[model samples]
Target: MTKALKASGFLGLAVMMAVGLHQFVILSGGSAVPPWMIGGHAHLGVLSILAIVMGFAVPALGVVGQLRTAVTGLFIAGQWGIPGIVWLGEGFGLTFLMPTGFLWGGALIASMLIMLYKTVTTEEAGGGGRAGVAPADD
Candidate 1:
């Protein structure tokens, strides 16, 4: 609900999108080369996970209940959606992606992005949100 949280959520969502696209490409017989960069998929996964954790932390500042609910909802959807996607992909002659890695990755990112944006924009009586400092505070 704060700017910082909103930013985190967006960043996380970006990560998720990247990972999902990567998986899709690989499954489509594109190339792991694209996904395998520096830390590679593994790294992306870890960073993305961190983003989610950090995003969750933002709610602690205020409106955490909403974030918790969002995350919980994402979790529930992931539980079924991910596996279902994988199954469908496999059925379509796809391998590599055994499960809906994209869904999980996307959800993580989406959750973080939401928090990050909220954290960055919301104003407070005092102190800066995620957008650095307010002129008044300075």
Candidate 2:
């Protein structure tokens, strides 16, 4: 999860930098900024931060094995794949890839929900520690 978080964070940073560069290009008289470019930039940046936060929360919630793998994999895939598909599709005018982007985006959302469910259930079942509720002094 740590490694995945790092990767996502770096990818997010890269995409953000690209957004800046894109702005520069637009300022310097490049082609009009495409909607996909702006949307992808924002989505990737936010999802990357989500991935990092999830990485920390996963261990805190005691997620492990297959559940952990699924959450991590799907989150990372969504973070990278959706924006990538958008970038490629818009950049190359390939509308076919747009559906693929939606699929990945959905997967990312699913993983987040699952993580939330698992964490909530775990805490309810008296397992891992909760984030904010004070621990008993026992």
Model 2: residues >4 Å from true position, as ranges? 124-138
Give the winner by lDDT.
2
The pairs that clash in candidate 2 are none
Worst 10 residues of 2 by lDDT: 122-131
Q: Runs in model 1 with CA error above 4 Å?
A: 1-41, 44-56, 72-99, 128-138
By summed lDDT, the worst window of 10 consecutive residues in model 1 runs over 34-43
**Per-candidate TM-score against the hidden true structure:** 0.36, 0.80
Cα RMSD, each candidate:
9.9, 4.8
Clashes of each: 27, 0
Q: Model 2, residue 7: displacement in angstroms?
A: 2.2
**lDDT at 92, model 2:** 76
TM-score of 1: 0.36
lDDT of 1 by residue, 1-138 (tens): 344434544555565567677677776895554322323334444454554555556555454576656754564344334544444444445666545578676885676576667668666546545566456764
